[model samples]
Target: MGLHGEELTFGVEEEFFLVDASGQLVPRGPELVFGTEERGGELQQELIRSQVETATDVCRTAEEVLGHLTRMRADLAASAAERGLRLLPSGTPLLPKSSHEITQKERYREMADRFGAIARSSATCGCHVHVEVADRETAVRVSNHTRAWLPVLLALTANSPFSGGAVTGYRSWRHVLWSRWPSAGPPPMFVSLEHYENSVAAMLRSGAMMDRAMLYWDVRLSDNQPTLEFRICDVAATPEEATLAAVLIRGLVNVALRDVADARTPVIVPDEVLRANLWRAARDGLNGSCLHPESGELVPVWAVLDELMAGLRDALRTTGDLEFAEGMLARLRSTGGGGDRQLAAYRTRNRVTDVVDELCV
Candidate 1:
């Protein structure tokens, strides 16, 4: 196996939209990124001025990830408050956004010039988990093991129930919107390292991606790091929820690393089954059913969670994250996933702004 079992350290990247006191989208945000960076944070500008991203340092434990996430979020919140702005931690635009200016980087400007409408409307935020791997080929291999679980993860963090003052019906309208990008969505099963590289080359030729660095796949080999980055989740509603996703993913990586060492075959489900499952998860969130990643039978999402935790039991205990992971799941159960929580708030006063107000904290 390429990756050492103990070397699968992880980190989290979260993107957020800038907003105002009344839960309206704030159009400009480079100052917010700078402000947070000045405060000793790792915040950076996203594609648009209305969005910012925070990337955490590589961490060895879920607890460490939680601390980093909490600190970075608080730093950004402080920065936003200083400018009388707020942050909205969801997938879709929470309100009718004002005009957005692209971030002033040449690459970003080029992206805007080429992608045009998609670039303009693609301020959708997400949570990305990066788990260290031995090499690019190993990252490609582990993805075959990890892609099956993406729908469940997406369901657990489906935070975009409404968009632009209208109920979107789907829990993750952001997922629906993001699907419009030519290069975005689940990664294809690759036969070998050559296969992966050639496929990426083909995407560039097709203009589906601007560069190797612009892979918008659910899981991809990091171009700049020795990691497998999972991008199948909405930006979680809270730090706790994000931590749950991160810990579970790290545990899964641990298991996959072992499986790779033993030469176990990676699970490969049909593409249609994978797409349908994602659709169901984005539609139903945790309130309904999704197809089992392997068996292809519809079952309660909680039952899949049980199966997942059972598979992850030993790995989590090894990391001393079993109890913390369970507690976070319990919190998800009590408060429901982000979509359920947002729907509950929207139901309370029949106002989408209330949902934004609640998330602002």
Candidate 2:
């Protein structure tokens, strides 16, 4: 916890697609970018050779997150440019080939072997936010409290409206593709930390997951760090948007922590309902209604967002992120989300190339 009794410390991890001069997916981009001996550990290869990931260090404020993400994105863009490639921060590849493009790593190979088709089809990119927690138990509590709101965050970050050079008719086709994983979606509420561990252990024994790291829940306790990870968002189109997401996630976690401290019971929506809400968010982004987590009633997406902001008002202020969050929210509503922006770009020239060009720039 920071000085205000809030765990505002957080970090962001973003995955990007590497494209060629014409904005087509480049199969060897990861090898060219991250294969060198001088490459830093912060940049890594994802499941696909054309995909690269960069993670920011632990950030104490939204400004720090923005700085780290800006530097990392600039470095990655420059590196890709040097290799005659362009780095595109998007959820799905605009022109991926039909075949799988796996990175040549042992773990990645093992994943391809185990998951088969699902692994092969995973050229998707996402943004993950990790917020520090006191311990495993507190992390579990925060995860439970935070699960209901994950869909709202997902809608805000929807950037993958097209896939394989055609409109998917969904704002976040990446979420649809990612939901194919057996371990994906909202996790069940656990009675305790031991219960959570046992549940994961059961999944491992069932051969449903390769390891603890394969637990792809929308929100989960980090396997390698003392933080609760939020995996519900697509990679934003810009560093500023990513930083906005990190700020909102930190605020949400802080609000959850305060609720736990006050002995407030976590909302326990049915798994089916939660999944439906997630689907709604993925399909519509902020253009349609969503299931209100607290009221169990369908409401406009903007209404749900306003409710979320209202709930986190104090926490956002306490963490010194209120003004920035509000400003970003207003801008998002005004200009529309990343998906809308992509659609607008496509609508302008009726060319997917233009969308890719816009995203890459």
Candidate 3:
């Protein structure tokens, strides 16, 4: 049976760091905050005890996403505050200490044991958006179509500019740090669902990754749900930013599915080119040029976004998210994105600690 457009529900998953009152990373705050029964399940500990993750329920509209995200952020912040810690939504800690403790879980323990220092040193956080699809076939197709655009999304949501108590000089240093993994970056094009499955199986057998969960492509088919998860964005610093990112991602999926229904061929940019484009976005964000996914020529970031929005216009209209998406995009363009805002704050105070303080609020 052909897939229907109305099945395009979406959800947002955001990872955040816990900081002390001085705006420094706290290695045990997540455990202290989320280990209690009263804290409930909406928040969970991450690989590192300094980090926590929260997910919103599946939402169909941008308004619902904004509402859920706002409520969850407030709840998580309150929980953290009660423990004398603050919730920080940036992609990386501005003043992280040399080491971070791992959460007390078997899976996290195994990851630390298997990966050694790499696992321990990874204190980065991110925002993931899952867009629902009808089946694995559609998920794979949507993932393929969405690959090129992931970097553009990353540029728009770049929030990590500092690491290890110093400026990293990259807009989304989280992406740079994440690229150290063997399975990160854009996924390769696949001819069919079987091809995608075989590729993941090969990665598993090769021992490069522990399991399917480690298949950390920029976008991928969700192993535990009927959705295509966009894992490229930094955890946005504000609720509105996160909501806008989710809305655009859902619209992108809708447009890709429509293309699939029409039997249009998917754009197949070379993996090398795709990786270069991702690097450019990570290093410079929207302040610089990006390689056009179709033409492979360097273009201003705004132009690329314009083309992308044009492609998704119908999907946005059908989903009733066009107005919200457009307004957010305009604001981002005018005021700059989260990373730019962080830098502006740092410049004003001449201190990374002050930047962290801004993020805490």
Q: What is the C-alpha lDDT of each candidate?
A: 0.86, 0.86, 0.84
Q: Model 2: which residue pairs collide?
A: none
Assess candidate 1 and give its lDDT. Answer: 0.86
Q: Which candidate do you rate higher for lDDT, 1 or 3? A: 1
For residues 225-311, what per-residue lDDT tens digits would candidate 1 score against the true structure? Answer: 778899999999899899899989988888887887789998897777788899999999986799998788999999999899999
Note the residue pairs that clash in candidate 3: none
TM-score of 3: 0.96
Error of 2 at 339 (Å): 0.6
Model 1: which ten-residue window has the lowest total lDDT? 1-10
Relative to the unseen true structure, what is the C-alpha lDDT of residue 38 in candidate 2, on a scale of 0 to 100? 32
Please give the lDDT score for candidate 3: 0.84
